[model samples]
Target: MGIRATAVACLALVTMGCASAERTPVTSTAERFLSAAGEGRGGQACLLLAPEAARSLDDCEKQIVSVGLRAGAVRGVDVWGDEARVRVDGDTLFLHRFPDGWRVRAAGCEPRAEQPYECEVKT
Candidate 1:
């Protein structure tokens, strides 16, 4: 798959997807992540990321804080099972529900024509 497709594929799986109450927590996680990043709290932001997504970067803590991520008004949310897509005023985020709570798997994402969202951070 193309690099962009990776982000969407993770959201495309659903044999029995439905509107979920998990939206609130999921959106909160994404908001907190962006808030931390925008505030230069790299460690805190990294704490909210999925493990693999965190490890995907050579220097996750440093890179995550510098990616220009920002918290904005939440525009929409779509949740399916453990996965979620949250649209903010200026960004798109993907998240997963871990055993502890919801964590971001991708952030600072944007869609291309027919391609998956191109994410600034992803696993």
Candidate 2:
């Protein structure tokens, strides 16, 4: 391959690697959020939430801790573009990718009847 062609191929490989890397951070963010909430570290949990999600609550620090969230083994993770959903035991979490990293947009979510998952905290 020509120099330009080789450079493009290398760039493509690098981009692919970066794309897959998102999975780790996304899963970790969700897990950390749940762990913090479960452990009664409200401040740490709030830090993992999206800015809008955090602001949506009148008392994020107090309310987030009392939402009955729990940390369990991650059952599954689906990442598409800037959005991600993680399933942890009985709870489902939705996250949004931000400039800095992924942040939880919703947590303590449960299935509903033909509707969006009902969430205890959402943006």
Candidate 3:
């Protein structure tokens, strides 16, 4: 292969690697948040929420669990800058990267027809 072609291929590989690395943490955070919420560990789940999102809840611990979140197999993860969307078997979650790490911005979201998602929990 030409030198230019080789450099392009390497650049593409590096980009793909970066995307995959970002996705891992996003997916992990989403799954952990869902698991905590689903298992009635509301306090744990609340800790994974963004500050605004957590505060949006009248009672973070109780309401977080009562939302009926389910942890299904993660089907897709899309990360853009510090924002991410995770799609599981029956749910979609949105997250934002914070100084500490990724935190849930919205959960229990359902896509609407040509509109933004409708979320049960959001900030």
> Given candidate 1, what's the lDDT at residue 59?
85
List, residue by residue over 2-117, the lDDT tens digit for candidate 1. 87798677666442242444676887898899999999999999999999999997888799988999999999998888889999988999999999999999999998999999
Number of clashing residue pairs in every model? 0, 0, 0
Q: Which clashing pairs does model 1 show? A: none
Error of 2 at 119 (Å): 0.3
lDDT of 3: 0.97
TM-score-best of 1 and 3: 3
Positional deviation of residue 104's Cα in model 3 after best superposition, in angstroms: 0.3
lDDT of 2 by residue, 1-123 (tens): 999999999999998887668789999999899999999999999999999999999988899999999999999888999999999998999999999999999999999999999999999
TM-score of 1: 0.82
**TM-scores of the models, in the order given:** 0.82, 0.83, 0.97
Compose the digit string of candidate 3's lDDT tens values, residues 1-123.
999999999999999999999999999999999999999999999999999999999999999999999999999999999999999998999999999999999999999999999999999
Question: Would you list the clashing residue pairs of candidate 2?
Answer: none
lDDT of each: 0.89, 0.94, 0.97
Q: How displaced is residue 70 in candidate 3, in Å? A: 0.8
